[model samples]
Target: MTWQLRRAHEADLEAIMHLETITFVHDAWSPTMMARDLGDPACFYLVAFPPDEPSAVEGYAGLLAPRGAVEGDIQTIAVAESARGRGLGRTLMQALINEARKRGARLIFLEVRADNPGAQRLYERLGFIEVGVRRGYYQPDNVDAIVMRLDIPELESMLVETS
Candidate 1:
């Protein structure tokens, strides 16, 4: 399925929150925090929906890269169970990376659950290297987070050379 991507607005809060609770399961961010991030000037959030059902949000991602910032962080990303393996995750991630670059970020960082190898693999394919581990970073689950870093210019250069 092709997903329609758009800058998340106030109206998307509920649909996004529903996916957040379902996807994150034991470690979803609070609705208050998500709402605040959506409104934050330094953060860029995107919501994806199928062309047929514009009101339903099947995936979403957020980036914390203020304009002129030297570094950025991928705050979070998720896709609905039915939407998995449909390239939506990759699309959302690439979009976030592009946004970070446009905002002047030279480096991008993200943290993935130690248990989620699929997401880790995706990041690795994007040229993100594991930097460190945050012990017990996830609340209520005690899941460690694998910290990863991607040098934006470096990855872009490599891609250009390979292409």
Candidate 2:
């Protein structure tokens, strides 16, 4: 249940890619692709590592934003299957969202597979609202993607209460 958050680096690309492939079924990014995203100037990557396992990152979250934009999108979030249900996902999200706010992001957005009720519930509980849907968003499986948005204008207050 204990972990630390830090900016992701090239060394974490393999772990990130592995987690993505395990958690997501479509649009999965390869290690090279994840590396590119992590290196992009507009993207923010955060990793969570257990207190005793500093050499291995247990979870990661990514956020992307254009310059001067008040809104940003969560590119991806994944926790190792063995690490699920321990609130690591939520913790990673909170860390990423707080970092986004520190960088001037006022809103946060993400798309999740419509079938992922667990993730949807988590996001909703954290203040995200269903905004729209992308039909046939996931290839192969062809599942819909529910678009969710969180207005972060009062994020500081909520974060304080949640913390």
Candidate 3:
């Protein structure tokens, strides 16, 4: 399947919010919250859409440039239920990594729910290492979050290998 990844626009916020809801039922952003992220200049948002259905956002990923030694951070990444298992999430992540690299990012970091094995597998496949753990990171459910870090050089090598 051919997928297109591009910078997200204001009009895509609603679709992204809906996709986020379906992808992250336990922690999804509302339309207003999504809008705020899109409005932030430091944040980079990208969406993957089906070639046949340009208006449909199949997956989305976001990154934020950081200060000091931290290069960038992955804010969120989600693929619609219908689009899962199609490699769209990986494609979205690769695109985000590419963008971050172009913006002079040396490292990328993210947090994943400890119980999300599927997501953990994906990140691991892309060379992200478990750096630390945040106990009780998620409120209410009190789920732990695993902190993952990926060095840009290693990621670039992995990207080339995958490509």
Candidate 4:
């Protein structure tokens, strides 16, 4: 399957929100919060469109990397259920990692729900290491969060090997 990734624009808000809501369900961010993050200069947001449906978004991801910062954070990433198992999540994650590298980040951090072994495996495949854990980080469901960190240099090498 072919797809394209590009920086998100204001016009894609509704589609992004739709995917985000469905993908994250009870833990989804509010439209207001998403809008704020999308507009923030320190944030890099991207959306992926499948080849057959160029105008339709299949996934989206975001990163927080301040200018000249040594560290960055994966703010969010999600692929539509229909789009899963097609490498959409990996593509979105790679995009965020590249953006973080470009912004001078030496390391990137992210938290995945403890129950999400699929996501954890993906991150591990991309060279992320388990750093710590946040107990009951995900509210309502009371899911623990597994903190992961990826060193930029290691990530770069991993990307090269995969490519």
Candidate 2: tens digits of C-alpha lDDT, residues 129-150: 9999999998878999999998
Model 4 poorest ten-residue lDDT run: 154-163
Q: After aligning candidate 2 to the native by TM-score, how far in Å is the CA of 138 from where it should be? A: 1.0
Q: Over 4 Å off in model 4, which ranges?
A: 154-163
The per-model lDDT (C-alpha) reads: 0.93, 0.86, 0.85, 0.90
Q: Give the per-residue Cα lDDT of candidate 1 at 130.
A: 100
Sort by TM-score, best first. Answer: 1, 4, 2, 3
Error of 3 at 17 (Å): 0.9
lDDT of 1 by residue, 1-163 (tens): 7989999988899999999999998989888999999999999999999897879899999999999999999999999999998899999999999999989999999999999999999999888999999999998999999999998964456464443
Give a tens-digit lDDT track for model 3, residues 43-140: 88998887877688888899887433348999999988888888988888888777778777889999999989999999999889999999999666
TM-score of the candidate numbered 3? 0.89
Number of clashes recorded per candidate: 0, 0, 0, 0
Global Cα lDDT for candidate 3 = 0.85
TM-score for each of the candidates: 0.94, 0.90, 0.89, 0.92
Candidate 4 local lDDT, 1-163, one digit each (tens): 7689888988888999999888888798988999999999999999899766757998999999997999999999988888888898898898888889889999999999999999999999988999999999988889999999999874446554443
In model 1, residue pairs whose N, Cα or C atoms come closer than 3 Å (at least 3 residues apart or on different chains), thus clashing, are: none
**Which residue pairs in candidate 2 have backbone atoms (N, alpha carbon, C) closer than 3 angstroms, thus clashing?**
none
The regions of model 1 sitting more than 4 angstroms off are: 154-163
